[model samples]
Target: MSRHSQVRESSQLQRRLESLNTARELAEGVLPEQELQSVYDVLERAASRRSLSAEHTVVGFFGATGSGKSSLFNAVSGSELATAAARRPTTSAPLAGIWGEDGSGPLLDWLDVKERHTLPPVPGLADEHTGLVLLDLPDFDSTRVENREIVQRMVGMVDVLVWVLDPQKYADAAVHNDFLRPMASHGAVTLVVLNQVDKLSSADASAVMQSLEGILARDGLGQVRVLSASALTGDGVQTLRGAIRNVVVQREATTQRLAADVTRAATELARASGEGEARGIKGNAKARLASELSTAANVPVVVDAVQRSFKRESAKRTGWPVTRWLLRFRPDPLRRLNLGRDDTRPELSRTSLPPAGAPERARTDAAVRDFADDASTGAPGPWRAAIRGVARDGREQLPDALDQAIAGTDLKATKRPLWWVLFNTLQWLALLLAVGGLGWLGVLAVLGYFQMPVPEVPRTEGWPWPTLMVVGGVVLGIVLAISGRMLGGWAARVRASGAAKRLKAAVAAVAEQRIVEPVEVEITRLKAFNAALKAARSG
Candidate 1:
């Protein structure tokens, strides 16, 4: 491959790694730790592998015991660097064979391989295997626990995997189920060799190869190349070498390996997090939540107080002058509750309204739960639980927040109407007229008692003016008082309606801040996580 193509491939791999990291961060508390651990391990391994040699391609030979993987390793290396013995598990530790002297000591050390052999350059072959580092790994199905552990660790770290299987064990359940099946997504960098094929006739060998191909297809690795090779007669070993040379020349095995790892990890995460799109909190759900919160905050009680207080103040202003002062002894309903304040610092004071009872609290809780359920309708269990947990945590602050919202609201109940002032002036004028007429009548009575001539009172409407003035004034003042009372009652209702709206609006604000927003935030997070996972999985 050209330098430009290599750069592009490297950039793509970097983007994939970033996307995987983003997914891991988003899934931190939202997904189960066990489910997310695989992603974490993939990222760690990718980072470590990238930090090592990018110039060299590390090919590992893995197989069960008696698979002759060590013999094949030696056959490919063109030297007996690996001990091919009759022992069931000959390769205890990994053996490294360097082709072109690229200073692979650091890379080998990272792989924990103590045994290393350097192959001398052989004219045309040297160019073919320039930057190849072959590893002879321990048997995956070994009896010893440490040997199995080494194979498992090396499986993830190697750039290319070559599973060497003898015909006898090629279809072994332990090799196919435990190893090959799990690596289904890594077909790009994987190769399977049916080693020791020279032990059978050519027709039998072809039959066994066909059967192995069928099994591999079922394992989701149908695209992986399967080669027939033998260490005894060197049959097909040259083809295997040519395949390795092609991979080394392209210099894309490392990137392909890491990309496959990321893809597999992202697939697992996507499965754990359900594929459903999050439908956010519904409109009716929000409305119901606000309504329940308003009830819990005693908003109706505050609205009623506003109505009664408006009427009380109205009576003091528009009542008959003689009896209006009597209304002052009655307490203002809103004042009694320490509400309807005109000051800017109302929030500093608490209202005397009663605390929410058990039923109100229960309704509020149910509303919050229902909202969470609606928001996380199709989400996975862990994601749904996370949303509910967020809602529950935010509810702890609802009581105080609602109280402050209520106290801070401008109820507009303390404002007096213009009609009250007009009514007050008319009542005062009528009272004065009645008093003046009474005084005039009294003077006439005194004059009669003293035997003096009394002045004739003016008459209108077939009645004396003073008598008419006293009767009409008193009657007009009483009529005005009754009319004002009726008007005030209607105005009180209007004021109460306005106050109810304001109080409910305040409660809605509290509900949104304390409950709805937090739950929606969790939903939005799930959306972002899913998007990142999609990007991680994309080519």
Candidate 2:
């Protein structure tokens, strides 16, 4: 083939493999673990197959429990290598008989065999066979469950399988439905050996082979070679041996089969667009999800919450005197009002941004987490969490999607500003200076009242100097107090604004880190897979 044609063929094959993989994934969802493994194992082997320089063949001795595989094994090797018995499961484990001078290391590894047997080449039985491994595995149609599993697992490892069957059970449902039909894809490497055909008349033997051929054809293993062989009469064992050598030993059938499987598997890989979702969130749904998320904790929502909080604080800070508040707006006995901010904010940082609240930010965060957990009902994990809205409603809990939104984020806060400590210090100093001025003014007034020229008896009280001292102190106190209050208020405003800015930033960051980017990633993956699936389907 030309380079271009080969590339195209390779591409086509890759597509098919991916579709097969997807189908397998679907099948695995419903099938039992063992059965799924059997199907998937073929696909996996198909992937590992590569064109090899020299050929090696594996002829497997596969049959029902009482089909005399051990007898055939001994006959083919021209010696007693396998134990033929009357047990329900004749072969308890796989015993490989390699006819190769080249080490059977890799082949055995592929088959995952722990037990091995070496048989020297006999004149007719193993002639011209440099790389043939005769594998006798446990029976598929056996009462022992492990026997069946062993056979099923080893099937894909062998190149060409020589199925041994007795005349009585050749047409059994267990033989056909359990083994043949499902493996119809491997027709090119399948053969049937009617063991103990000498038990039947020549005509009956021919008739059975004919019928079996027809069944094999229906299963797509048409052209399946059939031979009448018997270990008892030694009738067709030589012919069967020659045939095995022709396919597995001389002709390098195993190598060819492996190449084809490799090509097929490569084709599947080429077709795939790679991992991720099949179909991504799209159209109205994406827009809807995003919109809903924004409504929950969007910029506007958070800003609104902060503003409301500000108004309440303002009313207290600049409103009626503290004494009047104590008498009029005392704490409500019925309501469980929080006096301090809750610790829920730090906890919520585990999965989401801090939640909104009137009093305790921590409590707000907890409520938001609870709400978000409630939102992603059918979705799996933090992957599809609800967008936790800002605390809009006056309720204790945040909207349902906050944790999902938060958990998705990396939760890395930006580095604290370098001047943050300096700024904090300046604010504290300004407040203290104003408070100190208020104390000084109070002391000056008290001293002035006492020293008002009441020293008729002694010089204990002074008039002018004391008045002057009080005047200067009062004037200095007024200026300092006024300036101090202004500076202190300014500092408070700056602090609150900075905090609000950080919060807004944190909220936006949570959206970006958690929900937005992840959704985009999932979308990209799904698109790639979908593209691959489409290409495969096209091919």
Compose the digit string of candidate 2's lDDT tens values, residues 1-539.
Answer: 24575455555665566665664454332234564454366567756543331345777888887788888878887867577444523688887777764756766776777667667777665643467778887888778888788888777567787889999988888878877776665666777899998789989989998988888788767867878899988888889888876665345354445444543433443333233232333344434433444445543433343333433333333332212245335432111111113333542433323454444444444433444434423332212321222212312323434443332332122222333344334434544454555555556666678885333211225544444444444454444444444544554455446544554455445444454454455434334434544443453
Which ranges of candidate 2 are over 4 A from the true structure? 1-55, 78-97, 105-125, 142-153, 201-203, 217-220, 230-239, 249-279, 283-285, 298-512, 526-539
Q: Please tell me which predicted candidate would have the highest lDDT against the true structure.
A: 1
What lDDT score goes with residue 21 in model 2? Answer: 63
What TM-scores do the predictions have? 0.93, 0.49
Candidate 2 structure lDDT = 0.55
Clashing pairs in 1: none
Question: RMSD in angstroms, all models?
Answer: 2.5, 12.3
